[model samples]
Target: MGPEGGGDALLRLEGVSKRYRRSGLLALDDVSIWVGAGERVGLMGPSGSGKSTLACIAAGLLSPNAGHVRFDGVERSGGGRLPRGRSAAVRRAWLGMQMVFQDPEASFIPTMRLGDAVFEGARYLPRFKGADKDRLVREALEAVELPGSYAERFPYELSGGECQRAAIARAVIGRPKLLLCDEATSALDVTVQAKVMALLGRVHRELGTAFLFIGHNPALVGGFCDRIYRIGGGRITEELEACERP
Candidate 1:
């Protein structure tokens, strides 16, 4: 099933469930959610409430134990895997979506220059085929409010906030249709969080990309999303609209 209230969604999770085999812990239970094209959706919960688990599943980084994940009308069921010959399907799944993690510094390779790190994924994108690496890296950095000079620096050289902005630059450079941000701003101070949020807002507006903004902070999520869903104990406890956010 698609999202309630109209237009075809870019991503949909229907009755999805996940459980860790090692600890025998249920991280998600019958979770259903959707994000429409260019829509901003928020998933909010406390720590250990299955927030990151759901994000990982939605992004196809992890498989759900049950239920279906639909992206752009294609469906991937529980425990499903893309077959070896399905190159197009694989490309659709990967190139159209991107994820940003909580720790920006850890997201990159310490040995690589920031410019190469940011352009690595994007270079394979069809739109950037034959595109100049330096130009793409500079433009991506500029979009994230970073100077082009910073691209020569390594991940260790940047502050947390700066590194996060670079991560955002890397994620957006590919022009992904959906961006899954898992605790993207939690590591930053209040002021830096605001700035990062503002940068995200600009990215969304300019690129018209849909977002699944996952975090523990209700205030931050509510401020950025059009709709909010609250999860607790591995289940969705509440759904809040932008106007109804608390």
Candidate 2:
């Protein structure tokens, strides 16, 4: 996907602004940035600093009061109004964008089987049915280094790290071009977090997936991302090259 204004960016935000309440407390103030294809950019900011708000806008979940968001040159509305009848079509065709949130436990269905949970979205694609869906489910599970038998287990049965991996497998099963990771590894133990980060890096390299890695930890971003953007006071305060970090 190309950037806005005819460039190489996979995602671009231009003069985007958002405010809450009548007093006009800005969550985002005319923020502008571009993420190139296969580029991993980390977003760092303290709590309540609007990093998540910006991420929500980028993911097409929240609409901006002003400005434009372009994904692969296609304009996206900040409002969550997907076109009628075409919503499914757009989602299926643009399987390149996926989001893995910070809290995997909140995202998964506690009652559903692990396999079903991972392949839940796949049911929307008609081409993947019965055996095809089963195969894809197995592949996704394996990709996350989970055993095939895990398919029968429920969310409560797996450890926190395993559950998170399952969530990631679900997101990647469709082979998205852009992966928005909003503090995805924040909840895991150090060892588990390292494993997940390594898996994500490998996926990015192997599939050429562009990653928008959002987090507060400089060390975590330094280990995985090529560039880092520190957001504060409703705007990006610093843009650093990871290679230059000391």
Candidate 3:
């Protein structure tokens, strides 16, 4: 990746804003952020600072009231309704812009086997089938250090840390260009969090996947990301190239 706005950016958010209808709260305010191809960027903020809200807009999960989201050099905006085909294209981009939430259990399909759940989203990709699909699932699980036999198990059979690892596996299975981690390791015990953090680093290094880590922890972000942005009041307040790590 080159300088901030130089070419080769994988994702970029330009002057985005969002507000909630219920309470009329402004969640994001003219926020601009970018992640270059294979770059690991970190976002840190206090609770309710809207880092997660910005992540949603960046991933196309929620549309912003203003500004645009650009991915793979294609500019997309959540500021307004899009044409049906454009919406579908956004959804397709989302498949490659996977996210892992704080609670893995909340995202699981209780009835589906772990392997099947991991492979669920990839079937839509053209000609991705049979042995290739199966291999992808197994490889993804292995990437997160989950045992091969875990694939046959169900979500209830795994511990919290194990489930989170499975969640990482599921996200990477699609070979996403961007990975959004919203407090992904915050729920785990210290030891388990360390393991998950290590797994994330390994994934970033091995896959060359750009990661946008959203959390309140400065040390975690400092240790993992190449660039760090601090957010408050729905806007990026500071850019810190150095922070105390680990």
TM-score of each: 0.93, 0.89, 0.91
After TM-score superposition, what is the CA distance of residue 116 in candidate 3 from its true location, in Å? 1.2
Predicted structure with the largest TM-score when compared to the true one: 1
Of the pair 1 and 3, which is ahead by TM-score? 1
- Model 2: lDDT equals 0.82
What digit string (tens of lDDT, one per residue) describes model 3 on residues 21-93?
9999999999988888888889999999998898878877788888888877666644533445665556566
lDDT of 2 at 212: 90
Model 1 per-residue lDDT tens digits across residues 1-246: 225653478888888999899999999999988888888999999999999999888877789999888777677644555545666756566567889999999999999999999997597777777888898899899989899998899999999999999999999998899999999999999999989998999888889988999998767888888888899999999987866322
The Cα error of candidate 3 at residue 159, in Å, is 0.5
Q: Candidate 2 or 3, higher TM-score? A: 3
